[model samples]
Target: MTKIVLYARVSTADQTIEHQEAQARSAGFMIDEVVADKGESGLTTRLSERPEGRRLFDMLRDSDVLVVRWVDRLGRNYADVCDTIREFMRRGVIVRTVINNMTFDGATKDPMQQAVRDALIAFMAATAQAQAEATKEAQKAGIDHAKAAEDGRYLGRKPSFTTEQFQRVHDMLSQGAGVSMIAKSTSLSRQTIYRIKDNPTESAAALASWGL
Candidate 1:
């Protein structure tokens, strides 16, 4: 029997191991086990460097399937992500992702097939790293914006949602909830949800500025 293990790396307060598992389940993956590393930044830490991530290295066996929310959960950058996935494929472990239902396997002996697979892996890995970099930049910008706003001057109109709503939106967003789902669940407008999703820090800062 091929055992399936779900691995999650939770770096933010909004993200949780339960949410990760739920996302995988929703994607039709019957996870047999879950291994998670909390407070681990995928931007800075390699998979083997994480405690539970290292456990996965020793625990996964040939023919076993390893699942993740995305390839980004596997490493810190493009090279690291590529190397980690390749290493797993080399071990005969099938690596799969929930987001795009991506699969990487080393069982193929065909040269053309291998080339296509390798190219796809490279593209995905590069995309993951690019996303991480963009997120990091956004966080930095948010921090700077917050610091600038600390001078006691009101910035703009208060946010439409309360602090609780903001937190809920963030939680749902982290769980891979779509904007429409969140809008329906929270009763917030799609525009408001889009604003929050695009500038989470600014949204939170707006709430704080208004004492909401």
Candidate 2:
């Protein structure tokens, strides 16, 4: 049987696997299983490196269907996202996104059809990556403006984790603890832990903004 699988990645705790699954179901997809990576930033972590992401890759078989909210869920970078999708298509799995009801299949032998599919994939991947970059640049600009106006008193978004908690997370990361372990011990989401580990400066700025 060709199973329908849903893969979801949330960069924060507020996002939920259920939401993605619900979106797929609402779009008339009968999902057999859901693999989710919570608290993991697509910008920093490659799809194959994520714990749940690895599982998703292993679970997908030839003729299976994989559904995601969008291509961004698969990856944040253009090359990585395009490569991952191509890998699946080569394995005979069908990839679809809920956002535009976009479908990508590798069954076509027609040269023109293949060209069209490849073009679409490239465009989507590039667009997804560009959007992520633009959002990050905008955030940095806002922080810079605030700092300039307030003599470094203007903080950015409120800290999602407390200083003490963040310290433990930092320590765990330094000690080479796995993301899941740190998340479990600190009661923090994987995304927050990743943010703290991958970008300490940004994390500190957030704390400073909160006057913590």
Candidate 3:
């Protein structure tokens, strides 16, 4: 049987291991192996620079299967992701994703179908990359507007908890507090904690995540 390796990533350190694990599990794969690189984005680094990508380069054997949450996880950018997939397919490694169950294998001998698939993969990867970039730009615009509205005296919305209380919550999370403990201490629901873990860029990224 071919080995199946799963890779998950988040671009911010604010995310916790539990958050990503739950996503992968919900995607319906009993992860054989999970490799994650926190606080890094696939768009900013070469494939070889990523821990999971590097491991994939070395560990993949002919006919082995590789999986990720999405196509964006496979590349430095849209083009890079597509090139990597093609190379993996050429190496006889079958690539799959848990989200869409998309697969690429070297078994396709038809050139036309291969060309179409390549085009589609590139388009989809590029779209995802574009969406991420656009999101960043939008967040920048929002922050700028918010700052303007405050006439340089901008303060963030009054969070439910005081800054001191928030600091304690952050500290407790850092100190390995369980969700239940955090809930009891901060009085924030488990769901809020999970949301914080996924969209941890509270300074800017959280603004977009919260529809602000």
C-alpha root-mean-square deviation, each candidate: 4.3, 11.8, 9.5
Any runs in candidate 1 off by more than 4 Å, and if so which?
155-189, 193-212
Top model number, TM-score? 1
> Can you give the TM-score per candidate against the true fold?
0.80, 0.69, 0.68
**Which residues of candidate 3, in runs, are more than 4 Å off?**
14-17, 149-212
Per-model CA lDDT versus the true structure: 0.81, 0.79, 0.65
lDDT of 2 at 71: 86
Please give, for residues 29-66, the per-residue lDDT of candidate 3 as tens digits.
67677777776777788677887668878988898877
Best by lDDT: 1
Number of clashing residue pairs, candidate 1: 0
**Candidate 3 clashes between residue pairs 3 or more apart in a chain or in different chains:** none
